[model samples]
Target: MPDDARLLSHPFDDDKLREECGIFGVIGVVDAAQFVALGLHALQHRGQEAGGIVTYAPEVGFASARRFGYVRDSFTKASVIETLPGSLGIGHVRYSTAGSKGQTQIRDVQPLFAEFAMGGCAIAHNGNITNAVALKRELIERGSIFQSSSDTECIIHLMARSIQSNIPERIKDALRRVEGAFSIVAMTRSKLIGVRDPLGVRPLMLGRVGDGFALASETCAFDIIGAEFLREVEPGEMVIITADGVESFFPFERQRPRFCVFEHVYFSRPDSVIGGKSVYETRRRIGVELAREAPVEADLVCPVPDSGTPAAIGYSQESGIPYAMGIIRNQYVGRTFIEPAEHIRNMGVRLKLNVNRALIRGKRIVLVDDSVVRGTTSRKIKEMILDAGAREVHFRIASPPTQWPCFYGVDTPEKDKLLASTMSEEQMRAHLGVDSLRFVSLDGLYRAAGEENGRDDARPQYCDACFSGDYPVSPADMIERGFQLKRSA
Candidate 1:
């Protein structure tokens, strides 16, 4: 949903950046849609707007179900899963970065299927297409009709126009004309396919389940269905999974890989692994780095709950400050809860998190959080802590300030909407009305992610563009729409 409409949805999570989608697929597995549903449930945190599953079986042909809500809400029922029985299936949990945003319609839900000259294929995409508007215009002029507003539909139209002899070749042909990040899970009757863009701006993992195979946005999804963690689907690489086994190919011209760094700080489930590193360990290391960079005199280190808990533990362990859950999250305050009046709406974060007044009162508290985007939540949280009679509040952010909007897939506010874009660290501290505020440096973040030398400006390792404004791939659509890039230093 858009920022304004978030008040009606989940206002507690609005200040944070959100990844747009999560995809999972399985091949050579009986009841693949059921496996896909479990995978999507594990990945629900990445996207909660809607979910869809498409499966192909010889007897039933193709079956699809897309519903506007959680996977648990829609795909769990026997009525829905029975209709989608197949040995090859693909599914998506969506949070709309490329399409209609908050206005997600059933048509926008994915596992978008189409029949082509070769046969029928369905795709579940997990990233954004930067040149979609231009390609969409060209395709429309060339007589390609679009259904949903999703940029991923452009790939379908492009594949339709391609003269390629097969679906995989047509996929490569279509991707060659498109720009930006993508980690796709697509399925034909006999084949389940996975591919990542040249930069690998998003994550996709390959897993093994007995003799069959799985592709997921994270290893946590693999964990949910008892699949063995294999390796990541490499950047610029494609894997075709069938009854025989898996065949790998590099369909795109390889560039220096720039996987999204924010996945470690947020987005991915803590239990997930990326590039052989545990997301939880990376976040803990981030806290270690943050404590080393910015230590403060606080009685207790407290996490903002859930997202900040691991980092807070690391901070406490490193700083010798006892860790406590100062703010308790209401585990059941779902997005469906309605605050019908202005006053009720104003009680924003209070609805989701309440300060542990007994633990917080009279303490000089250190509140650790993943990142501060607009600082609205930070301000509200600080107020709550102060009202609980805390003497002072210090904030330690896991990631560096988000200074730019993400074009590759993450749903972020415009540059100006980012508090860090217009304010210095000290200014943000003043704005949040905290005793002090510090964010992990970009290099510090890189070090925590296993880069010993930290970020290499000459040849950077990962995508920290949200913090640094150094986009690995030019965002073609935004540039065309008149969004300015950061001037070189």
Candidate 2:
């Protein structure tokens, strides 16, 4: 594993759910690493800490580049791309959800590679494997030497130990032993492969790029590389692509799909599509549903900026209030802005966001934001709004209150640290010093995501454990470590 060379996350970024990773792969495209880089760039919002790419050409064989920073910073340079020349390639952008958090090692970065008895293979994975600890312990006891602390590395070891003769077959043999969510984009010497876990707790999509096929975490990535969207890799399904065409297989038991509901709320780009619906339209509908469920009279409807803009627009249109950009985001601010000095650290959200004082002064404001986790950022924003002479600040969240910690790859504060876990809506309002705080109900959220009759309590159509505390898959490792499941009613 590469040494911990220090990667800094934005100081204020701690208030939101941290996305796990983004992955992309191509098998038949010329300059395939370039396309993989472009696709990872499009999905950068999912993970920004580090990136890696692996490629294979008959002349060069398996070559890899993993670095601790943005993809644009490293992969864009010809010097770096030149080394990875091939027609088949895969890449990964990572944020630490399953391994070391603030301290990331270069080797911890992905497109993790290994050489098998059959051949060499590289894999990029999203989502957490719930039983990784037990699997790793067993692997170590059985004499499998470990390299990195990542859960994804366990998959490589599992594949190496498989009795299956072929790489794809070994993948099936390996995945069957793991639990929880995973959406993987992997490359064998001649093939590009994609797969989703049994429950479909995360997302993986297949697209067509010229004669070659592309696999990515979202449709937005396909759009970036001029790929035509084909369809989603169904839950429990594996897709193998070569020059000939694409082949699909179901390697796991079928179950009710449990696609992460939060993707519609925050993880995915608004322009992307999931479950055959536009993410932007779904967020807008969330605001519309919120207006009907919790209507408020205010002078202006304003968004917190960026993530909140689409929903604010919907709220304004539904409530007959004009929408305003009350908060301005500093477009140039990068996560690399390190605040080592106390005074600089104290600048906090002000460094990334500022109130449009002229537009905010003396107005009754309704502030729409995506989700509130620890309440630190919300309180800061509220203080900033009030300081700018806003008469009243009402908060409307686009998603249900996140009350439980996510074990399926999202980085979340512990359950006790989550504001919703410890406080009621009224208490949250008081804590943030806002006039009112309202979140879209879980049922309303489902309806916004196109569930006509709302969330089915009998059998949820999506994974909403962060809000509902009804985990679709048992968090086996957490249970062993004394993390209790939600109490039965």
Candidate 3:
């Protein structure tokens, strides 16, 4: 039951940049759909708008259910999972990025299914195809009918028209023609396939459960389902898993991996591991780096809460400043910003966070946070702190200023909307009405992420394109179509 009329994930939260999608797949298990449901639930943080699961069973063939809402609500019902009886399954959790046309369309919700020349296949994609518009035009010219307004559908059309001899070969042919970040999981009647693009801009990890193989966007999914974490699906590599075993192929030429750095800053479960580094550990290290780079003599160090907690702990430990929960988030107030009334929306930060005036009053505070986009959140937070009688407020950001908009997957605001893109540090400080604002340097971030040698100017280890405008994958569609990049990105 795909729901095209489903609502957005609190439009007010659009300011928070989000990962495009999350995928989970499992092969060689009875009730595989259950595993997929649990895995998708664990990955709910990555996407909150919609969830779908596609399962294949000898008795039932392929059964799918896509619904708008949380995975726990959409896929956890016994009646729903019972309908998807299968021994092989793949699931997708999706959140639309900004400019995502027809965002509520159920047809765009995936693991999009298709019947190709090779066989029947269902695909779930985790990254944007930068050249999708161009390829879509070419495919349309050659008479391919597109069912959904999604770039992931382009691969389905490409695979259908390929002259390749097998399903895997056709998939390779399709992937080769695509550009930008992608971590895909697809299922055929008897096989499960996982692929990561050459640069590995997105994350895809392999795992094992009992006698089965699993694939997921994050290790946290594997954790929820009690699976053993295996190595990551390597850059430019694909693994085809059948009942007998798994076979590997590297159809695309390999390149230096430029995994998204923001994954550590805000995405991914804190307990999860990426490239062997603990996400929580990296955040703490980032706080340590921030303390070293910008030491402030403040009465207390307070994190912005939730996303900022781990880094705040690190900053407190490294700088010897006691950390206090000066502002507490009301977990129950999930989407207070959704109030359509202007006065309610104007309430803003107070709706979600309440100032602990007892802890904050008369305190000189160092507020630790992840990143500043439009500075609206920071400005609101600063006003809240001052209203609580804070003597001074200094802002310490964990990552470098976000200047470039993320085209690969994140829903970042355009260049002109980004405060850092237009304002200098001093200007931003005055704009946020803070005594001072300091963002961790790019090299500091690399170091916290375990790039001990610092960033290699010629061959960077990670994609800091949001902070540094060095995009590894060319934004072919956006550039060729004249998507007005700042200073010719």
Best by TM-score: 1
Tens-place lDDT per residue, model 1, 1-489, is: 456676555556778898989999998888998999999999999888899999999998999999987888898999999999888899999886443334666888898999987789999899999999999999999998898988999999999989989999999999999899999999998999999999998999999997899999999999989999989999999999989999999987879999999999999999999899999999999999999999999999999989998899889999999999899999988766664666767788999999999999999999999999989999999999999999999999999999999998888888899999999989999999999999999999999999999999999999889988899989998998899998998
lDDT of 2: 0.90
Candidate 2 global Cα RMSD: 2.3
Residue 443 deviation, candidate 1, in Å?
Answer: 1.0
Off by over 4 Å in 1: 97-102, 339-342
C-alpha positional error of residue 120 in candidate 1 after TM-score superposition, expressed in Å? 0.5
Cα lDDT tens digits for candidate 3, 1-489: 011111124423444667878999999888999999999999998888788999999887899999887887788899999999888999999876532334468888999999766668999999999999999999999999998878999999999888988888889999999998999999999999999999898999999988999999999999998999999999999999998888999999878899999999998989899999999999999999999999999999999988889999999999999999999998876542365566676676787889999999999999999889888888889999999999999999999999988878776676788899999999999999999999999999999999997788789999889998888888888899676654652
| Alpha carbon lDDT of each predicted model | 0.91, 0.90, 0.88
Q: Best-fitting candidate, measured by lDDT? A: 1
Could you arrange the candidates by lDDT from highest to lowest?
1, 2, 3
Which 10 residues in a row give candidate 1 its minimum summed lDDT?
96-105
Residue 278 lDDT (model 1) = 90
Model 3 lDDT-worst window of ten: 1-10
lDDT of candidate 3 at residue 146, scale 0 to 100: 90
